[model samples]
Target chain A: AQSVAQPEDQVNVAEGNPLTVKCTYSVSGNPYLFWYVQYPNRGLQFLLKYITGDNLVKGSYGFEAEFNKSQTSFHLKKPSALVSDSALYFCAVLSSSASKIIFGSGTRLSIRP
Target chain B: SQTIHQWPATLVQPVGSPLSLECTVEGTSNPNLYWYRQAAGRGLQLLFYSVGIGQISSEVPQNLSASRPQDRQFILSSKKLLLSDSGFYLCATRGDPGTRGYTFGSGTRLTVV
Candidate 1:
């Protein structure tokens, strides 16, 4: 079964500091990885995805993720974090042949001003 | 240009009461629809998904049920709501084949007392 793991439950960072949220996935075939952000009481918003080609994928709101095939990781990163960037981040993986995507447990990102 | 509309945005229901949540899609046709529940504003738990009208696939067996009567309409219902069902419910649609990401609705905050 395909699964996604987000190791950190919460990450705290100062405003303007770099931030990283770790994610790892396990799948049988080619993996379609995605990152989503959710605010309190709201649904998730798509951030980025890695389907093929580029290992470093850029996404909405100055976010980027690196897909490491050998390590089975797709980590979300931002060069400079902002207070508005604080939210719940989820990493999901979908196999090409699968019908649905598998989501990670989620990581709470807190950016202090 | 795909969009998902889920309502009522917020809901309060007593335990054992019947519940219904509706979701509709626009700017797309025959798209895959999904229903997910987020507990405590954290990880998402996929409840159901459908590829076409009248084709529902359940991921977890619980107090909720989903139906797809129209190509763009999806409904989540429960005969008797439980206290545990109180959470944020999200409706989503799979994006185009090239993107392979999901576009989510604004979400419905359901509080079952």
Candidate 2:
């Protein structure tokens, strides 16, 4: 079955430090990878996506993800963490053939001031 | 600018009660719509999706059902609510023939008592 995985349940980083939220995937064919952030009870907000071409995809809120085909990973990263960036981050894979998207278990990011 | 709207930002319902959640999209046509549930702020579970009117495909078999009465309108319903159904429900949309990521609604926080 096609699936996305966020190995870490939580990631902690000090404010202004570089942070990374890891993600991996198992799927058939080329994958359309994406990252999303959720704040409390609000709906998810799209961060970035990798459809084709460039491996490094930048998205909203100063977030970017590196899509590594050989490793089957699309990890989210930020040059500098912010307290406001603390939230639930999810990695997803879109199956165009199946016409649906699968999400990972999410990683809770905490940035301490 | 594509947008998704989900109603009833928060809802508290009793067990065995009927449930209905609505989602609509704007600024796009022939869009693919999806319903997802997040349990305890964790991973997202794909519930249902619609490629077009009257073309609902369920990702998981559960007490819930979905309908697309119009091109841009999607609705999720349950005959009887279950305690396990309480969570953050989000509606999302992706444009057809496009590689962009999905746009999600603000989500509905449902609590079953």
Candidate 3:
């Protein structure tokens, strides 16, 4: 089965510093990877995705993710963390030949100001 | 531009009550719709997805039932809501299934008392 793994349950980062949340996926064929964020009492918001082309894909809220096919990893990254960046983050992989998006266990990101 | 909307931003219902949650998409057609639930401090669990009207695929078997009466409208219902159903409910859609990413609605917070 296709699945995703988030190595960390929580990540703490100081404001103005770079942040990374690790993710790894397992799939049969090439994978379509994604990252999403959810704030308190809000629905999930799309952050970024990797379909093809460049390994590094940039997304909303100054966020980006690197899709490493060899390592089967797609980790979310940000150049500079902000206090407002604290939220729940999820990594997903579309597994089926049809369309099936499977999400990983979420990671809570806390940006200490 | 495309947007997704979910109704009843917050709902507190007693156990054994009938429940209904709605999701609608605007500015798009033939969308692939999805329903998901999240418990507090956890990741998402996909409940159902639809590729077209009157077609629903369930990811997990539970008390929840879903219906898609129109191309861009999806509804999740339960005859008798369980306390375990208390959580955040989210709806999402994609223009096409395999190639595109999903856009999510604002979400509905259901608190079963």
Candidate 4:
């Protein structure tokens, strides 16, 4: 079974500081990883995805994620956090042969101004 | 550009009332459709997926059911509602491998009392 784990339930960061939301995965083969963000009472918006190529993948809204094959981790990162960037983040995984995508427990990101 | 629409934006129902949430996609064809639910402060739980019309695969056993009567139409229904079923329901669609990523609807907030 393919699964994703988001270790932190919440992450707090001061504005202008860097922020990280940790994510790890378990899959039988190479994984297609994606990160999504959700604002209050809204649907999730796609931020980025990692299919192949460079480990560092940049995404929408000045966000990026690094896919670490050795550590089986795909952590979301931002160089500078903004108060408006605070939202719920989810990490998801899907193998090429898999018909469905599995999502991890979400992490609530809070940026204090 | 592809767009997904889900409604009603907000719904309040009694414990035993019937429930139905509809989703439709535009500017695409033969897309893979999915239904997901998010409880308070939790990640997305995939409920059902459809590869084509009248083809639905359920991921979990619950009070909800889904239907794909048309290529761009997906509907989630329940014979009777439960308080536990109250949450935000989201619909998503993705094209074949060439598509960039999944597109999500605005979401429907259901509150069962």
Top candidate by lDDT: 1
Chain A TM-score from candidate 1:
0.99
Instruction: State which candidate, 1 or 2, has the greater DockQ.
Output: 1
Candidate of highest TM-score:
1
Docking class of 1: medium
Candidate 1 residue pairs that clash:
none
Taking the tens digit of each residue's C-alpha lDDT, what string does model 2 give over A1-113?
68998999999999999999999998888888988899998888878888888999999989999999999999999999999999999898876575777888999999999
What C-alpha lDDT values do all the predictions have? 0.93, 0.90, 0.91, 0.92
State the lDDT of candidate 3 residue by residue for B4-112, as single tens digits. Answer: 9999899999999999999999988888899999898578898999999999999888999999999999999999999999999999987443334778898999999
Clashing pairs in 2: none
The estimated TM-scores of all candidates read 0.97, 0.94, 0.94, 0.96
In the order shown, what is each candidate's alpha-carbon RMSD? 1.1, 1.5, 1.6, 1.2
User: Against the true structure, candidate 3 has what lDDT?
Assistant: 0.91
Complex DockQ per candidate: 0.75, 0.70, 0.63, 0.69
Task: Give per-residue lDDT, candidate 2, residue B45.
Answer: 88
Off by over 4 Å in 1: none
DockQ of 1: 0.75
TM-score, candidate 2, first chain: 0.97
lDDT of 3 at B58: 95
Error of 4 at A104 (Å): 0.9
